[model samples]
Target: MTAPSAIEVQDLVKTYAVRGRPPVRALDGVSFDAPSGAVLGLLGPNGAGKSTTLKILTTLTRPDAGSARVAGVDVVARPAEVRRRIGYVAQRPVTDPMDTGRENLVLAGRLQGLGARAARARADELLERFDLGAAADRLVRTYSGGMARKLDVAVGLAHRPEVLFLDEPTTGLDPHARAEMWAEIERMTHEERMTVVLTTHYLEEADRLAAHLVIVDHGRVVAGGAPSDLKDALRGDTVVVEVADDGATARAGEVASRVTGLREVTTDGRTVRARTSASSAVVLPALLAALDAADVGVASATLARPSLDDVYLSITGRAFEAGAAAETEEVAA
Candidate 1:
């Protein structure tokens, strides 16, 4: 028989009251299942309820409606038990700046009920595993951003919980630091066999780290599946043609549509786009010839396989960057 799901959320709803204004609906009918030993990404823009969902699952907040289970225990009914079985690393660093990394880890292990000797041993083990052994005795304030973040992850693992929740794990790291963190997380899941639920706004991060991805938008899940599967479902190569103006764009689309294998020919400003199952070489020449016959000036053209960005655009009818900006503005308001 298959092992039980490590995390499950069913039609979760949560609302927050605002002073002198209507309550905001943070989560609406959000649901997904994360199998054991899988890294599940909860992906979305700001204010998409990604954080809210994590809050509920981590037992930091109560859901207004629906049910959730983590490690086979109901969240609402036995929050303490659920908390015991999960490790949470928030978006911001939670390590005390004045404390040494070793101190923080030992304290965390102790709080989780490990004895003094056990906590010290666990702290040293994690320090070595996360490559913090060299600086383990240094104050957290002396650590670099990447080092501090790794320490945060180590603290979360101090108790060795069944499931780990990481909220925007690489949000503030530089590209290099982020890459290092990604490697660490990969080791955590694959080598250590830890189950993880990671919420992140970085599209590439989800594509790189998650075994399964759930894209949430405006308090609901818009799409979900393995990253490759979601992209494959779009089913063709994306051909983008850049033209001089609206007239050229329109003509380009008209010309592109005439190609036998091209589908969904459309125009956005000076850009003309279409999808085709044929190879780019097989379709490019015909498409270029058609545009040339129409006297449409081509600025540039590109052929790419379908990606997570394409899947998001197809389902949401908006680009990921645009949605992210909108969500940020909404949160500010």
Candidate 2:
């Protein structure tokens, strides 16, 4: 049997109006389906409608045109039901600074309609599981960034929601904390059997954690598939060969074109990057033979299987890390 969709969005649109200005469209004709018990990585740069999409799914905001359903509940017609079934962790901080970690989680549960006793019980369990038992009594303002973020996640899970929305969950975390959060997310998804929809500007994070991905750009999806499949779509492997100068670069391109089963040869004065089906059997050996025959000295050569980052660059014309940088600017402004 096929798995059911945890979240389904069709022709979603969100437009914001400002004084003395044309309305700004956040999400325009967006559509996708996420399977139950799967992690769908909704990736895009800043202002790419990622946050807008999450807001619609979590019932924080309503779409202007299209319909969205989370856990089989229509977002517009039954937003309350959708909210109850889905847990939302925003990209920004939402916990109260005056409240302790445990107190914050308990309050969130109560707000979600859990009884006092049940809320406290769930809070304790999550605090212990998230490795926050020792600091559960600490005030949120006094807690470290990582601890506070963990508490926010704990609050989202307090209601035992069926689908979770984590918007840039590790955005402000340090390396160690980020890794810990990733592991925690993986563990919780497995243990609770909940579907997760996460948005992130970090390609490495998406590559490592997501089982499937949908790459969005400027309010539209450009690519969607498993990471391996997307990477394989770039063709066999990438070979980066460094040569002497512009002349060597041109010669290398000519050589790569002559080499069988190779295409998309891009040169940058001293570096030549190309895609080839037979990296081991055909491309590499042919390039080496050509270089030798042309008397063009090769500084170095390296072959790497295509990565998710490569796919992003291929579709967007910019590096993934560059998009992260742009997102920083957007957030700051």
Candidate 3:
């Protein structure tokens, strides 16, 4: 039998009213289920309602309509219970600079009603687990950006919650720190057996971390499934053949089109990429033959399986990098 859903959201609608402008519909009839012990990626570009959806699920804010639940407790009706079972890490860093890392975690646990001893013990354990043991006694103000972010997450997990929500967890993290955070998150997912709902604009993060991927755009789920399944749905392998000059792109596509199993060919500048059923059998040989026949110079050729990035672009007509840029713009504006 299938396991019961750890989190369920149905027809959730949330809108915010600006003082001078019209209300923005953040979540428009959004729906999805996250089963126990699974990582569900809530993916989308900026203004796509990823944060709004998370707010509703964590019971941090009320939805204008519809309903949601965490661990079977109604998000709106039993918000306290929902909080008790979930660990929430917001998109922005939320750490008290006045307190030491250990003190912050201890305070969080005590606020959750744990005994002083238990809270201290939990703080110590998490500090070590998150690689902050040496600096546990240091004030949060003394910590690096990544270290402070780690403390924020540790504080949220003080109660050993069964569900965890990480909103853009690696955002603003340096490359090395981001890798560390990824490892830390992976370890927590396994050790705690927690159901994680991760909202991220990073396509590779979702592809690597989430067991189930859900793509949301403008507050609607446009795609949902396992990463491999979604990639497979796009069909076959992709062969990219780069030509020497700008005029060679169209010529390369024309050549690739005549290839036996190639389904589609697209040319951007001097690069020609094609989706084909048989990269080995029809795509490679036929493309090379055609290029040779046309006297076109082949600089390099690469065959790769489709990635979640390709799938995202195929569905949304926008690249993940573009989405990331838009998110940054929204933040800046």
Candidate 4:
């Protein structure tokens, strides 16, 4: 028999009141299930309600409508119990700069209800497992960004919670550090068999790490499925034409749509983006010719395998980068 879900959210809605402005709806009927012992990634832009969803699941805030459960406990009615069963690693560091790495972990363990002696043992075990044993005695202020991030995650796991919540787990780390964290996260899930729900802005990261992915936009789930399944849904290739003149985008899109085999054609700024089931070998030439026929100047064009970015664009009509950069204040508000 299938095991019960680690998290279940149905029609969750949350609204935030911004002084001097209308109240912003941060969540609107958001719903998804994260199976036990798997990673569920909340993928979206800065203001797309990803963080709001995490807050509700972690019991940090109550939803205005709908319902949620974490580890079989109703979040609204049993928030304290939900908190006890989950570990939260926020986007910002939670470790104290004045304290050593080991100290931070021990304190977290103690607050989670471990005895003093057990807390130290758990801290030592985590320090070794994360390869931070060498630096466990050093003040957190002296550690690099990556080292500190690992410590933060370690602290969250100090209690061996059944489910872990990670908000933007690798937001500020360097490329090398980000990769390392990805591998570590993967290892922990496989070995610990714990449920992890992480919200992130990186398209590739979501594709690489999540067993199940949820795409949020404007406070709702636009699409969700296994990462590979979602990418495969848009069969064939993504065609991108970089129009030389910004003014020609409209003409490029209109003319490109008339071309055979092209679908989901849309324009963003000076670029015309679309998808086609035909192989690039047959479609690229026709696409360019169509643009040329419309007198649309093409700086360059590319055809690539459908990716998470393409999926997001196909569903949302906006590039991942544009969405992330467009508006960044909703979560903060």
Q: Who wins the lDDT comparison?
A: 4
CA RMSD per model (angstroms):
2.9, 3.6, 3.1, 1.8
Q: Residue 72, candidate 1: how far off, in angstroms?
A: 0.9
**Where in model 1 is the C-alpha error above 4 Å?**
242-261, 265-273, 277-279, 286-299, 329-333
Order of models, best TM-score first = 4, 1, 3, 2
Work out the TM-score per prediction.
0.88, 0.85, 0.86, 0.94
Top TM-score: which candidate number?
Answer: 4
Clashing residue pairs found in predicted model 3: none
Instruction: Say which prediction, candidate 1 or candidate 2, comes out ahead on TM-score.
Output: 1
Q: Could you give candidate 4's per-residue lDDT for residues 1-333 as a string of tens digits?
A: 876799899999899988898889999899999989989998888889988888888877889999998999999998889889999999899999999999999999999999999999999999998889999999999999999999999988999999999988898999999998998889778988999998888888888889999899999999999999999888879898999998899989999888888888888888888888676788889989887887888999998889999988888888888989997767553
Error of 1 at 75 (Å): 1.0
Candidate 2 on 1-333: residue-level lDDT in tens? 978988888999788775687877777799889888878999888877788788778777778899988899999999989989988888888899998988998999899999999999999999998999998898899999998898888888999989989988998899999999999878766776689898887778888878789887777788888887898788678778998665778887788778787777766558777777664566788888888898888888988889887788778866676665675222110
Clashes of 3: 0
Runs off by more than 4 Å, candidate 3? 19-22, 241-260, 264-273, 285-300, 326-333
Residue 63 in candidate 2 has what lDDT?
82
Query: Of 2 and 3, which scores higher on TM-score?
Result: 3
| Global Cα lDDT for candidate 1 | 0.87
lDDT tens string, model 1, 1-333? 865689889999998887898988888999999988879998777888888888889888899999999999999999999989999999788899999999999999999999999999999999998889999999999999889999999889999999999987887889998998899888888987889999877888889999999999989999999999999899888888899666777778888988978887767778887888677788988898888888998989999998787788788776676678777522222
